[model samples]
Target chain A: MSLRPYLTAFGLQWKIGLRYRIAVVAGLVAQMWFGAVTLMAYASVYHAAPDVQAPLSLRQAMTYTWIQQSLFTLLPLGCLPAIGDAARTGAIVYDLLRPVDMWNWWLSASLARLLGNAVPRAVLLACVAGPLAILVGLGAWSLAGPASLISAALALLSITLGALLSATIVMWWNILTARTLSPLGSYAVGTPLAVLLSGMLLPLPLYPDWVRPFLLAQPFAGITDIPIRIYLGTFIPGGVATGLGLQIFWLTALTLLGRLWMRQTVNRLEVQGA
Target chain B: MTQSPSHTLSGPGLYRRMAGASIVAQLRYPGTFVIQAIGNFVTTLLSFFGIWSLFHRFGSIAGWDIGTVAVLYGLVNVAFAVAETLGRGFEVFGGEYVRTGSFDRLLLRPRSTLLLLLGHELRLRPIGRFLQGLFVLVAGLWLAPHVQWSAVLVLPWAIAGGAAMFLGVLIGQAALCFITVEGLEVVNVLTYGGVEAGQYPLTMFGRWLRRFITFVLPLAAVCYYPTLFSLAHPDPLGMPTWIGALSPAAGFAFLGVMILAWNRAVAGYVSSGS
Candidate 1:
């Protein structure tokens, strides 16, 4: 359960990953190229129609897409497959036998992997988006500092919780069957639900009368949309407080669920005789 | 339930048997299959909603009406869904097959690598997306109230071509993974980014992007020009409607190039053992 062994494990994985350094760099470059294409498309669309709905101006939409592309680094959709693979291969048994708390061990491993993967990719994506952001004249708002920090923190929390939840599912079902559900859970259930409910996609005022309350009720909107709103200095008094409160609530709930699942699954561990 | 005989299959027949087995393996978990199909449908639907919402807000974009845009969306989705389903093997080749070196096993089989890979996985769930696309296409046709029988007849060819193009992108991605998995993002610019770009008319983009899609990627050949012809919209790019009608053929040519690249990459991998 100590941090030393976990850190060692993390370091080992990092080294192995580094051996394929070219592949990693290539992947980053490919992502940046697409990011550039996306920026260009957004710019073109904005030029064609200067105003895409009331609240979302050409600049804001471009900025929003940039931020979204950048933060996409923190998404946990990819982690579940790793968990599922380990479970399927019965490697979870070896992973669990290590003298570490199951949750802490897995979390550390994933965090290490994420750092190995996301950090470099994020840097590259930012480099790509930064020039485009400037070229598109994305304003350097005063709130960018606070908003970005908050968004980053939220993104990390969301990814961790998402990974845990996904890992828990893999513990029950192996990778082959889990493939379909995991992506659905991550993409269909988690990301968009978060986007829609968190109020990230549209501001509350812009939403129709019937949908506003429902959209506000979902926890996901708070993850990205709320931070963006705050960055834009559009957060009203009560809404900002409520959004932050909801984010904390969701994080706590997800963490608890993950822990419970991990404990139960580990207790029932039936490592196949390999 | 009677299972098919294993020994009776040979050569192309063996490949068919293998493909059938893979499909059956997927079908073993019908619940997962249904959920995944629904998930894909929902995700694709959300994208359509995004486009629809834009149309609702702006009435028209780049001189294209909602219905015309819907047709474009439908065509792209239909093509993409078919590609995602049939080309599931190629899509995962980089991450799953090439990364694990299972591609060598594929080569050892007494069948064309393409057939064996195509048979490796068949995603039935994207059928949900395909149906949604079909609905959209029909709706667009109804809304436009146009009946070009020739264009209608060529629709299948275009869809096949588009599928081939996307599949080629996936294959190319897998091939590049051999060289370096680092910049898989560039492939996304062609695959995922292409889907988004193809959803709208190519003329909506800047000259550079349009040319990239047309010459480098040939996406416009599959979707935009044929769409203009189908909707009776004048080609802003000055290409005749017949060219659009014939554009999907380019997709096959693209696939041919990718296959050659894939073969070379595989040969290099075999020699270098990287």
Candidate 2:
């Protein structure tokens, strides 16, 4: 009913997320290294198969790799680390006792955490990989920006939706952690699924033809791949509206389904113990 | 209690007993064990699919066919999984051992700390990643049509060496916790990031990077060179044919250096405590 608690939850989690300054910088270095490695791999693959007629050019693929790598923390890799900790320590019961909409409270907290971790790294990496690399005369290997002004605007809108979709998925992982009372399952299941399905492992366009459609339609694609494609000005078979529409559809559908699941899980937890 | 010389077991026997105990403790919860194992396998399998789709599309990248890359991918995954299975204790050492002051408990034991930690490495869950890697290795070997009896002998050795290298990385990460726990995650760049980089051929990278992995990290020694030798593929950079046979030793040497670092870190912790 009241927005105060949820906003407070958001603000608290955001601060916690930002506290790991060392981790953010360290993670940036690692991501940059891996991004460079992946870009090189892409360059070699594209160059080796010049006649293959891939959907994205080598430059577009390089840019995609940079964006994906920079935004690696943004992907729903697992449930909130705090939830995992609380579940382990039996402190999660306190979360249930709070006088707020549990779903919104958790959702806002999760979103704040995601954005808090991702935005700084994304900004720093964009500078280093995009403008800084260019400044250093490594423009060929640097990340190319959004294809056009309109493409940039749409990409910004879609990435916001994408972040929400990712957080929604993390909610499911959180609920799973709550039910299981162990953080291990969420990570063991969440990580590889997100990395592969989100096209963080490879550009969706680079996958085989039959698999491409499935990759495009999957909810994970809505997280990063669709937006990146839109940013790159690649022609989506059903166009940009369809891409944005799919993300919205998944966000709404998943939120509704997740809320039901959370309610049932809470009831089960209450009847027994978290 | 009276101790008898005749009742004293060898170091290997003690290690076996300790490892066996850990394995039994892990299996105490069969449901969670199975789920984690299966989850791990599925996760790695999905990542492999990313490669499968790539090969299915472009046939090969940088003159390395899918089969060759698969061999490299499988070997590295299998090696990393083996390390993860056995060295899980070391992997969590920063948070679980040092921060919790469990290292003091370990020091109180009569057995050497390295042996105790080594014994802790006999975890079971990584079998999933192991099985998936083996599947890919077999598939790659089958598809490649390169028949070499020596490869059978060489493959296991390469895996063992690679596992040692990764275990060494884990140890180095643990050592860093003595100074600061906050930034130990950067070590993941060497461990997890290494695995990702090792998935592709070293030749795919630039000259400087190729040299760094070969001479510095020595990934080329364990993964790239050995696979090249097995496939009988000539080096584009023309290092030498015999380099592959000797490269695994690089991993062993790296492990040796990490052990020295670990010793220094432990000593620092001991001195700082007073």
Candidate 3:
């Protein structure tokens, strides 16, 4: 298939995502604040009981939190605002009329928006949380580098898959909005599920050992947790390959299932106005 | 109409009726509401579980155990949920009212803007966060080693104060919208970030953050200070025990200042004047 329409869709949403410079800065500050508080909490917890054989060391957990906070926007928080607006104003019908493949068009936009929102914030936050914290004599709290060059390369690949997996999840929310005729339901359901499961609130490795396997197996874990594991070179159930495999698995499975769901939603959708 | 809004309701009665009607409307979608609430509860509960898991591995963090932390967690969340429910309108004021030019319609009404905004809707979703926090608080109180009988008397006072502080943050955010609606994420740092910060003991934070929350925002003054008092935990941070009772007043004072700021913002607002 031709790539022009999907690229245009991607470009449009990417520009919209990058447009809000102030919001990006604001979100960075908020994430920084959260990261600081979380780091402190971990520090105290780890310090109070140094002898415990915790799954993640204090440094690893801090790094995980910093990266997680930096990539906060990469999580599938809700349906795309454009889709929500379209659904609300009956402009979604025009989206249906567009001559491009609906799934690809929406997926490109979803992926672009997530990248646009996430990339700048992640870079800026990494700089501040990594180098800047160390420069300011807070090296103990800084975001550490990947376990090795191999891990770094693998992490980059994993994060790309992570972002795509996140966008794929957003597609599910988009289809849900199209089905429900309201974006509220998507957010009400999507946010908590994504935040909790994706290790946004806490690193999946830090969770109880019994729960860790189930947490790893979940689709949300593939979005960030698995990639972060690869980055930290932490134990990923079977091995590092298993972490990357999980991301690829979720991305492919979700995309295939999402396309079928989208087709069904569109088949049944009835726009109120002509 | 079955009943004229003006005839049966006036002042606080009207506010109650407004809240009541909104509740009734939400209740119409019982399934949706329940799902959202359960999602919220589980999401928060899982985060707490992360903390529980850590404590399971390590005996305590910074001398405070899970129970004390839970009390702190419960207080801030319950407070935030209450503020979020009541202040949903104010939270969305800039986007829903100012950006849409609906602020003009609100002005056209005879009722006070504060009442109208406060009455917009008592959101049901945060109830999930509230209930989850309450569960943690009760559990924490039971499990904590350092409890006193006076906790029963002091806990409600602290919750009221924390709610006041959060509401103040929301109002301050609404007031800032008068200047620009672009950077509201900065305020989310205070509100959502505040909830995260309040879940831990105040002393655990760095000096700057501890001071900012205690003085500028009073989040710590209301939450951490009172929890310390309730648990009868000695001040690792050097504040006297009696300070908890008086510190909650800071929350109220913060709210008063924010109200004035809101009124000033309204006065300065230049309508489209069509």
Candidate 4:
């Protein structure tokens, strides 16, 4: 499959998305406001109870929360509805007729979307959240800066993989389920699962002995906890490597599964050429 | 053979028709509704587990016992569920309807936009969240061993107030969508973030955060203050105990302001199409 056409498509999407810059800025402002409120809430709780038994310090927790909140926007919950709509309306066939491979083309489109939507918004959140973190005295960890960058990268990768997985599922399922799963599944399954296993709300060390193994085994942990742990210097360099290994493992697995689903559903494909 | 311009349905009749239509649509998908309800109940229940784990180790936070915290959590969920059931369409308006231009259809209808929007979707599934809230609320009563009939009478009123407050936030969010959909994440700070904030007593937060919730968002007026009155706890904010008892009324007032804001936003959309 030719890569140039996909790149061109990505560029087009990015330009289209960039047109709504004002909305993007507004979204960032809103995130910052909410982040400030949440950080303050946590600070108050920690102030009230300095001896809270979480693994990290109060500052670390606050920063971690900010990171999690910011990264949430980066994650692709599902854009299956768009895929389904395009397929249903006969756009998919037109896309297939293009020189680019379907998977690569879609990936390019999603990348463009991420660039237009998540990247600027996340940067804006970071800029706003940075001062708030400083004001709240939450940036005490020596590893925060490096950890945040690594976590953000990992978060982006995880979200891309997640979106692909969901898209593949849409290929297998009908459009209604695909559309419902993309949004609803992310919140119902993905986000909550991430919260539980990723140690977003609570640390994994705090869980009971038997539960830890099961929680760690889940893919959600790889999304936030492992990356955050790497950032906090909680994990040794080797541990970080292993964490990345696990993430890659899951990403590859999900991707292959998605591809298989896509191949199976292609025969049933109906699309509107754009 | 001229028609009277005043033949259209008004007030209660219009509301009843809208409400009936919404209910019918909801009933059309009873299985989906049941599954969604179960999902809502389980996810909400899981969040409480996080708090329960905290209590397991620390006993109480900020001099507030598990029972008291449970009451707060329960009330917040109950109120949010009420809002979700009534405001599903608006809750998803910014992301789903507005983004897709489906909101324009609502404008085409002769009914009040607010009424039609509210009636567009009613999620029976939030009944799961409501029931879970009821369980926690009863547990709080059981643990606290409080038996004030007057406070009991105020419970429904408090729920109503909380619902109004939550719905107001959703409306505010929908209004914001008129300007931009990019940074809509900020609204989560008020809606989901508020729920998290409301889960714990306001006293647990820092002074600034507390003041913000009290004076700015008036979240204190809905959950904390009324909780104190209902549970017979001291008024931390030092308002009259009656203030706690009557604070839910503030939710209605807040919602009223949001409605006006919403109308203004709709006007802006009509003029600018932004």
lDDT (C-alpha) at residue A87 in model 3: 86
Backbone clash numbers for all candidates listed: 15, 1, 0, 9
Worst-scoring 10-residue span by lDDT in model 3 chain B: B176-185
Candidate order, TM-score descending: 2, 3, 4, 1
Choose 2 or 4, whichever is better by TM-score: 2
> TM-scores, in order shown?
0.78, 0.95, 0.94, 0.79
Displacement of the residue A56 alpha carbon in candidate 4, Å: 1.8
lDDT of 3 at A148: 97
Worst 10 residues of 4 chain A by lDDT: A169-178
Sort all candidates by DockQ, best to worst: 2, 3, 4, 1
lDDT of 4 at B93: 77
Interface RMSD of 1: 3.9
Which candidate model has the greater TM-score, 1 or 3?
3
Per-model lDDT: 0.63, 0.87, 0.88, 0.68
For each candidate, what's the DockQ? 0.35, 0.72, 0.70, 0.38
Best candidate, TM-score-wise? 2
**Candidate 2 — which residues are off by over 4 angstroms?**
A270-274, B1-7, B181-183, B271-274
Query: For candidate 3, lDDT tens digit of each residue in B1-274?
Result: 4876667567899898899999999999897898789988988888788778767767776667788889998999999999999999988987888777788998888888999999998899899999999999999999988798888978888888889989998888988877785328788888988998888888788789888988888988888888888888888878898888778888889999999999998988876443
lDDT of candidate 1 over A1-274, digit per residue (tens) = 3579778756865565466555556566655554455455445555666555545554555555555555443444334345556655666567666667766556655555545655565566656556544566753410123246665675455444443333333222322223332333444344444344433333343444456556555545544555555554454348556656655665566567767766766666665438
lDDT of 2 by residue, A165-242 (tens): 999999999999999888888888888889989989888898888878888988999999999999999978889999
TM-score of chain B of 3: 0.95
Highest-DockQ candidate? 2
lDDT of 1 by residue, B127-223 (tens): 8889989888888877764647676767778888899899888888777777764236556667767887888777767677788989999888888
